[model samples]
Target: MKSKIKAAFNPRTWWPKAKDGMHNMSPLVAFFLLNLFLVWIKTYINYLVNFNLGVTGPIQNFLLVLNPIPTAIMLLSIGLYFRGKLSYWLIWIFNLIQSLWLFANILYYREFTDFLSFGIMGSGSATGNNLGKSIAAIIHPTDYLVFLDLVIILVFLLLRKIKIDRKGIQKRYAILTILLGLILVFVDFGIANVDRDGLLDRSFDNNYIVKYLGLNEYALFNANQTYQQSNTRKKAGPKDLQKIQQFVKENHSPANVSYYGTEKGKNVFVIHLESFQQFLIDYKVDGQEVTPNLNAFYHDQHTKSFDNFYNQVGQGKTSDAEMMQENSLFGLNSGSAMVKYGASNTFESMPGILGQMGYTSAAFHGDVATFWNRNNTYKSFGYNYFFSKEFYPNANKPSYNVGYGLKDKIFLKDTAQYLQQLPQPFYAKLITVTNHYPYDLDKENISFPATKTGDNTVDGYVQTAHYLDQAFGELMDYLKKAGLYDNSMFVLYGDHFGISENHQPAIAQLLGKDKVTDYDLGEFQKVPFMIHSSDLDGGIDHTYGGEIDMMPTLLDLLGVPTNNMTIFGHDLLSAQNPQIVVFRKGGWVTPKYMKYNNHYYDTQTGEELYLSKDKELAKEAKANDAYADKVLSDSDKVITGDLLRFDKRTDFHKVNKKNYDYSKKATLKALKRSQETNPSSVLAKNDGHSTTDEYTTDAPEYSSSSK
Candidate 1:
């Protein structure tokens, strides 16, 4: 019976035990246990960070089940070591396999570099913050974990050499391994049960394994709630549709009347200036000017300057700005919306709308069309032609290198030539590319005119801007000479804020201050949006607007009938409400206040704006939260392909067919329909919720109360 029991416990009992058996066992066990713990920790952390655990319960459970492989390997290694035949070659092989597997998994997730960057020091390392360091520390643990494990094995071997037989110790290790294996198997089965019910309604809370694990339950709960909310939006009832329709009907105005321009078959030129900011024009350098041409244009032209305009580019930066401006879609939160959605043929855009109106449409960029996948996006957006670096003659030859493309001068000249060649009444989008990063003009070998003066880098940027300004002047002059100026509309806007700390400092110096208190870190993102035409009546219009509003506003001005399906933007000339600009960085800037995520910043001081008395600030906070929820919900629809179905069903005229002459009959009909459908309007009135009452009247006013 004793022999049988011993045989069951140890298969190696028939073989003679080596002196180093005990010595090898400890190091092997320690290494195995430490690695096992690390693998489990990493798996848990990755699930927490990437996937919402509550929503991905099944996946999480599966990961947990798989988490024991490393540990099992380590345990097997320990048994081999305790067999007194542990080879250095076998240990090296195991280490190599583990290292390669870890690296392979990391690379597969595109996080290998991130892992190595935490003082691990590997090629193509992607360094993050302290979070990365903590993760690395957990993965490797301490040298002692491995050293002690090896030391224990060595100790057993040493003891055995000194005439100590440790047969009982081996029997104890066998029992311990079996117990651990059984425990892990049971845990894996438990996790599997939760995973199996992950998609069920009960799985939301009942089958949420992470909740039991006490790992980021709040985040998991929030994720589940978000998913439910998204489903609610998707499965909106007839009542919800009616509410939306009523909202549009009551707020809607005649497109032409609302946009402040008569409908005509005018050629539209949209220039998206890269990284151009409002401060560039307003800022003065050494008691002089940084952007003399832009300043002069603002002053001399029939300009309507929007003092409260804000930039709302999402994570996609330039592409996001373009998408917001032209597509009338909200900015994306995660990926490049333009690139992702642009490739699909189903996506609708403003250029596509214009193209439907029998106008030739084109997009011009001096850079490669492949950059940001503009070529595919533009084509999908119904552009008949795309002029990129490939279209430029001798573009491969060495010239002044701007940020992402050829010099501004070359881009401007090429764009102008293309525009001149295009058919009349064409919709042309010109994206300029001089004012990008590295801000070094001398490095690019670009020279300015004799009329300009400053340090080479500043002078180079100034010169580049001047060159573009001259190009603009030349284009307008040509149009005038050709008698096309009166029929063409020029819409110019900046893609983003310029990268010039020197310009900011220069502005501060000119103002005789260290920093502009009114300008916050977020304020640097703001750029200019202007619409200029020689034929239209011009005045200073301090209108608050953003990139998303551009398309609807322009479409309205062009006398194109638009529906809610066309855009989220309201007509800038309509009597709608005060404008709000939202950023992907989770902040919004209005005329009176700047709101970050859950916090409001004082517009002037850039400090946290709060109430000294009572819970008035709390009420505002609630409203802000609601606003954020609405915005995010609306944005998510567009990003997640839910909005694509509306493109096919929408007929702009079906919703917008009003009296062209603003007749009372049409107005009365619209009013009656609006009144019948709008329960929210009644609710708002009953609640005394007026836009003017909510915000301070002393805040900077826009030219129109619309947007």
Candidate 2:
């Protein structure tokens, strides 16, 4: 037995035989293996150097290396069906395609912090405008390595050192290779699932998809997704639109008359609080309040805040929140409407609705236009102007733009320059990003210490929230001083949960609980939603609602009816609004019951109840599960089908995407032109002087010399 084992392992005995086998191997087999090896090496190299895949531990690292092999196998095997020179050229073409794909992702990841997707490719005009300088900026010498193997192979081909066989690979060998590749693909998928459960299903992150599955596999996945959505849209007709319209009509709740039109004609400013949760509203760290400005706003006499407000974002996350806020429509169950349907879908959005009333609408974000595909999405929402990263001064500077966007305080301060220039009664959305994930803050900007929870993710969350709070305070001061606060309506809301469920140990410590159960994680989805206007009555109302209610509630307050449009959310202030809180991942929470996956929990108490044990509880859970599923399915139909394009209603005009441009030069030039013609901007109201100068802050980055 020992001798047999030694014989099996010994390289001295097998080396000569193995070398002879290689020497006698067929040219077709050699060519296939060589291409496969080359593609695998370059993909792994690109993964390591160009992308931040968050690959952890040895298993995931092995899977990352293994993931690219099957794609090369499956792709290269196609040439096996042809003969001689034709087969060789076909194989070379596929290899070249893969080479180009890897290089494209490297450049895209540098600019967007994301991999290339069909969604992005379908809307190339957004990033392809300045193909010369824009792409050149992201290119580095190391990126050229993706084509190293191809170049070497080309050189070898030119020298005729390696010759292609005159005959094609046999059918049996080709079939076997494909079968082996398929088996390997499934094996890689199974290992990834074991490592991170629901990573393929529940994770909407492109980075996660590429990290778990190879770049080639992710492209295939996205291509399949794009084809399905495109086919669905193409097959859709007026009947599908009618079905969605009926659903919307039935789901709609009438606005509460007592609070309707309360802030009519007021300047509407939406502050998108990124990754902020509801628990932080009154949370205290040592002796200091985490969010003093938001806390005061929650209790201010002129504010209306909801303690039970929730965020109904899906895989889209922040973009989903924005989608629900703008159009009163739920985001797709799998991806963001902004990225997937933004270019094609027609919206009866907040901007378009207000635009009809002579309100010039704009959206403000401190990131590039391509992030979230907002450049085209905002136009579909009928926003006349979009002040993206290009509009900000020195936006490319590291200090100005950090962690996915410009620093919060600097963003608000600089936005004032453009904000004052906008027409009065304008609807503006300012998206804050300093409080985003990985929650890092500048050393000088840190006002609070990390929690002793020992979890780095949870600890950093507080300090970033503190910094975001400080930024919000600075903006509020500026608004008040500029005399905009008195007449303008301020809507501040937390977009989603800051800390992920993966850090349960740290979350348990932070919450002072013995254990953090699945129920607690679901309950953690609550986010702060507050509406503040100087003339309005303020109170902490215990109304249960989600991000979907934002648009309808605000429109209701402005006395705008939503009967003609498709809106999934109801006004929180309405007595008739349903108390059901729907989650994107097939979960629903009501005042009495909470349902997630196959588990049912008592809403007030964190007690899990089995459906087999209680008949009444089971009935309620079943009904909610069925209804929530229906609502989600119906919404998916509307979103994936682009059914709104079939609506020929005269009340809401179809958005002409050509009328707007988000580029800095064109937007500023158009703003100037508009101010001259309309003369309704705050700057115009102030006799051509800037009101943006009144803003001040204690933030370390604040400068008195700033606009």
lDDT by residue for model 1 over 1-707, one digit each (tens)? 99777765573552334476742434444444454455445444544443222333355556544543524444344443443334322443444444344433333222111121111121111112322432342242332232343445455545653222223234455564656666664565466555444322322121133323322222234445445534643564445434444444554544545345554578888877776777667554345565665666565455445555666764456777888787767655434565555554245577777866767677877766666767666765667667777667645755534456666555554454445445556788888776653344443233343223333333444545544554455455545544446677877788765433324444344335677432454566568777766656555566566777788778877877666553556665555644666655455666656765334666656776664442765566556545644554455455554445444344421111111212235423543343335422222333422222212111011123421
Backbone clashes in candidate 2 total 1
Compared with the true structure, all predictions reach lDDT values of: 0.52, 0.80
Backbone clashes, each candidate: 7, 1
**lDDT (tens digit, per residue) of candidate 2 on 1-707:** 99966854453432222335552556767787889888888889878877767676798899988999987899998888777877777777799999999998887666435566665565455434433344664477888877877888878877877787776655656776777789999998898889768765455456667777788989888787767777898788889889878877887888888889989999999999999999888888787889887898889988999988888876567888998999878877455678878977877788987998989899998878887789889989999999988888868888766677788988888899888888888999999988876677779888797788886557888999988988898888888888788889999988877776656688788788988876887788899999999888888898888898898899989988878777778889899888888887556888888875436889889898787899998898778766676677677778888888888788878878888888888888988887788888878878888876587766565564554
Model 2 TM-score, all chains together: 0.74
**Candidate 1: regions farther than 4 A off:** 1-259, 443-483, 500-519, 604-607, 611-617, 646-707
Give the Å shift of residue 473 in candidate 1.
Answer: 4.6
The root-mean-square deviation over C-alpha atoms between each candidate and the true structure, in angstroms, is 16.5, 8.5
In angstroms, the error of model 2 at 40 is 19
Clash pairs detected, candidate 2: 303-538
**Candidate that scores best on lDDT:** 2
Candidates' TM-scores? 0.59, 0.74
| Superposed Cα RMSD, model 1 | 16.5
Measured with C-alpha atoms, the lDDT of residue 398 in candidate 2 is 81
Per-residue lDDT for 625 in model 2?
Answer: 67
